[model samples]
Target: MTRSPVLELRGLSRRYGQTTVLNDIDVTIPEGSFTALLGASGCGKSTTLRIMAGLDRPSEGEVLLSGKDVSQKTTHQRNIAMVFQSYALYPHLTVFQNMALPLTMRHLSSLGRMPFVGAVAPGSSKARNLIAEKVGAAAEVLGLTDLLHRKPSSLSGGQKQRVALGRAMVRDPVLFLLDEPLSNLDARLRVKMRAELVALHRRTGRPFVYVTHDQSEAMAMADQIVVMIGGKVAQAGAPRDLYDRPASRDVATFIGHNAINLFQPADGMPGLHPAADEAVIGLRPEHLSPAATGALEANLETAEYLGSEIILALRSERGTEIRAIAPGDYAIPAPGSPVRLGFEPTRLHLFDEQTGKRLEVAS
Candidate 1:
C-alpha cells in the first residue's frame, strides 16, 4: 500500500536579496518513513529544513503539510517538532523540565505557568499532572529517568541529544525535523545513536526529515535520500538506487564511501565498451582489484592496511591514478612494482563528457 505523503515541498525556492539559496525544490516525505536531505555545507539543505519547520519562508513555492498549504504558518502553528544539532537544551532546567517545556507552553494558560501560582491557579493542577505523565513517559523511552533531575551542563553529549529528542517526542508532532542531530557526537557514539534513532522512529510511527552532510549517515538511517547539489535536488530515491545507478556523475562521486575513479576520454580508455570512446567512465575502488592476468596494468605506489582490507594506490601506464581494494590478507608488493588490475565490465558507469549526465550503455 502506498502511504500518503505527510509533507510536500512544491516548487520550493528560497532567496536572500539577490542571492538564491534553494532553487525549484520539490520533495515528498511519505508518512512513517525516514527521508534524508543530504548535501554539502551551504547547499541550502538547512534552509529547506527551516522552511519546512516554518522557521523560514520560501520566496517561491508552497509548503504543504498533509495536503494543507502552510507556506505562511509560524513554527508553533505548524505542529512540527525540530531537533537542532546544538541539542538546544536549557542549561538552567533539569532534563525533565526541558522535556516538559513544550507541553507546558502549549497546554497551560499564562496564569497557570507562574512558578508558585501554577500550583494553586484554577485548572493548572490538572494540566501539570498531564504534562508530568507525558514527560515521564518520554524520559523512560529515552532511558533518561535517572538523569531527569540533571541539567544539560552535567550531561554528556549523547545524553543531551537524547533529551532534545525526548522533548520532540513528547510533542506528538505530525512530522519530525532533525538538522544533523548527531553531528556533535564522537564517531563511536554517533553510530550507537543511529540505532537508537531508528528504534525511536519505529516507536513514534511518524515521518522523519533528517538533514545531514554525511553520506554514510544518510545511507545508514534513511529509506529515502535526497541528494542536493548546487541548491537543487540532484536525486531522490532509495540509498541503493542512488548508489547502484546514480542520475549523474556528481551523484555517483558523492554517494559512495570511496571516491569514484573517473576516466575521461583523454585518459586512455580501458577499451571496456564502444561507448567509452566518447563518454567518461567511472569505477569504484572496491570493484577494481589486483588480478594475476588483469586487463589493465599499473605501478603500485602505496598500500594502506585497514584491518579487513588493503587500499592499493597505483598509477596506470597512461599516467591516470587509480585506487583498488585488496583483501587484508593479500601480500603487499614493493613500491614501483607493476600490478595488473581487473574489474567486471558490468560495473562500468558511462557518462556524457560534456553534460556530466549518466549514459545508458547496453551490455
Candidate 2:
C-alpha cells in the first residue's frame, strides 16, 4: 500500500541578512517512513529540519503537515517531538520524572504542577496517574523500566539516550525528529542504538525525520535519504538508487564507504570506453579488484587487511590513486609491486567533465 505524505516542504529557503542558508528546497516525507536529511556540516540540513519541526521558519516557503499549511505553527502546536544530539535530560530529575514531564505539562494545570501542593491540587491526582501509565509504557518499550529511578548523571551514554527517547515516545507525537542523536556515543554503542531506533520507529508507526552527516548511518536506518550540498538537495532516493546511480560527482564521492576512484581523460588509462573521451569515470573500490588478467595496471602502495576483505591502495601509471577490495584469503603482493586491476564495464559511471553531472552511457 502506498502511504500518503505526512510532511512536505515546498520552495523552502532560509536567509540570514544577505546570506542564504537554504535554497528552494522541496522534500516529501511519507507516512510511517524514516527519512534522513543527509549532508556535510554547514550544508543547511539542520536548518531544514528545524524548519520542519517549527523551531525555525523558512524565509520563503510552505511547510505542510498532513496536507495543512503549518509554516506559522509553533513547535508545541505542531505536536512534533524532537531529540537532540545532546540527551537533553534534566540532571535533577529521575528517568521516570523526565519521561513524565511532557505529559504533566500538557495534561496538568500550572497550579497542579507544584511539587507537594500538586498532590492535592484539583484533578492533579488523575493526571498524575495518566502520566505515570504513559511514562511506564514508554520506558518498558525502551528497556528502561529497571533504571527509571536513576538520575541522568548516573546513567551511561546509551542509557541516557534511551531516557531521552522515552521522554519523546511518551508524547505520542504525530512525527519524530532526531538531530544526530547517535553522534555522541562510542562507535559500538552507536551501532547498537541504530538498531534500537529502527525498532522504535516500527513500533510507533509514525514518520521519522532524522538529520545526519554520516552517510553510513543514513544508509543503515532510513528508507529515504535526501542528500543536501551547498544548501540545495543534491539527490533524494533509496540507498541502493543513490549508490548505484548517483546524480552527480559529489554524491558518488559522499555516499560510499571507501571514496570512489575517479579518472579523468588526462590520466590516459587504456581500455576505456569511447564515451570516456570527454567524461570523468568513477568506480567504487568494492567493484574494482586485483585480477590475473586485468585491463588496468597500477603499482601497489599499501594494503589494509580487514576481517572480511583487504583494501588495496595503488597508484596508476598516470599517478592516479586508486582503491580496490580483495577477498580476505587473496595473497597480497609486496608494496611497490605492479598490480593489474579489473572491473565490470557495467559498473562504470560517467560524469560530464565540465559540469560534474552524471551522464548515461550505453552499457
Candidate 3:
C-alpha cells in the first residue's frame, strides 16, 4: 500500500495583478525521499518553494504535511527547517552560537536572552546545556566540530553552507527545505556537495524538498524530480524515468545530456508512418548513427570528440540541424561533406508540435 505524502500541494496557485505565476499546481513529496523542483527562472519554481516554506502564501489551495492542512500555519508553527540560498548566517556569531539559535530562542524568554541577564535567568542553565548538546551533535555530523568557534567571516563558502545546515539540523525537524543551497559554490564545490548532500539525506532519513534550475544537479540529487513550467508541474518522476520516458517535448529537451534531435513529419523517411496526431519526432543523439543506407542525407557540420564518444552535428536538406552520437572511432566526413544518419523506428518519439506533448504510438 502507498503511504501518505509527507508534504503535498493541492491545487496550489499564486498570482500577481493580471498575471498568474502558478496555476493549480499539485505535488506530493514522500517521507524520507529527496524531491527537487526544477525549472528556468520566472517559471514559479522559487515561488513554489516559498509557498511550501510558508514564506509566501498561496492565492488558493492547501498545503498539507503528513495529510494535515498547513496552508494557514506560519513557518514557526510547521515542523520544517529551511535553508536559503544566501546561507542566512550571522557574520558575528560563532558556528556553535548560530546552530543553537533556534533552541536558545525557543527556551529563553526575551529578558533571559540578553547576554548578561540570561546567565542568571530561571532555568537558563538547563536550556543552555540542552542547546549546547544539540549544537555539538549537529556540528559533528557536519564536520564542524573544530570550527565551532569560528564566525561566518572566517569560514569558506562550503563551510558556511554547512554551518547554515547545522543550524537547521539542530532543530531536528521532520521536513527539510533547501532552496538552491549549493548554487553559490564553484563548479567543483557544487559537485562535491551534491554527493555530500545526498549522503546526508540518506543518513538523516528525512523528507527533503530541494529547489534548483539545473536539471543535471536535480537528476543527481533527487530521488523524485518535479519539472516546473509556467507555474505548473510539466513532469514528475524518478530521474531515469524522466530521462528515458519524457511525457512531453519540453521535458525531453529539458532533462537530457544534450539537445534532443527533433524532426517534423514534412522531413519524412521511408518505412516510418507517423500517426495522424504526430507532428514531431524526438530522438536522442545516442540513438542516431551514421549508416551506409540511411534514410536521411545531411552534411556533417561539426564533430565533437569526447573521450569515449563523438557527437556529430548535421544539417539536413530541409535546414534541420540534428545531432547524433556514436563511438569515438566512427569515421566522420569532413565539414560540409554529405553523410547519412540512421536510427531504429522504435527508438524515435512522436510528439504534437502544437501542444508540445508526446503522442502514444500503437505497439
> Scored by CA lDDT, what does every candidate get?
0.93, 0.92, 0.87
Per-candidate TM equals 0.97, 0.96, 0.95
Lowest-scoring 10 consecutive residues by lDDT in candidate 1? 268-277
Q: What local lDDT does model 2 show for residue 244?
A: 95
Residue-level lDDT of model 3, residues 42-98, one tens digit each, is: 999989988988889999999998888988888767968899899999888888888
Judged by whole-model lDDT over C-alpha atoms, candidate 2 comes out at 0.92
What is the C-alpha lDDT profile of model 2 across 1-363, one tens digit per residue?
Answer: 388999999999999999999999999999999999999999999999999999998999899999999988988788999998998999999999999998988999999998898889999989988999999899888899999999899999999999989888898999999999999999999999999999999999999999999999999999999999999999999999999999999999999898998889887765656776678999999999999898888999999999799999999878988899999998999999999888888888999999899999776
Q: Give residue 222's error in model 2 in angstroms.
A: 1.1
- The per-prediction tally of clashing pairs is 0, 0, 0
Q: Write the per-residue lDDT of candidate 1 for residues 155-216, one digit (tens) a residue.
A: 99999999999999998999999999999999999999999999999999999999999999
- In candidate 3, which residue pairs clash? none
Q: How would you order the candidates by TM-score, starting with the best? A: 1, 2, 3
Best by TM-score: 1
Off by over 4 Å in 3: 268-273, 276-278
Candidate 2, position 317, lDDT: 79
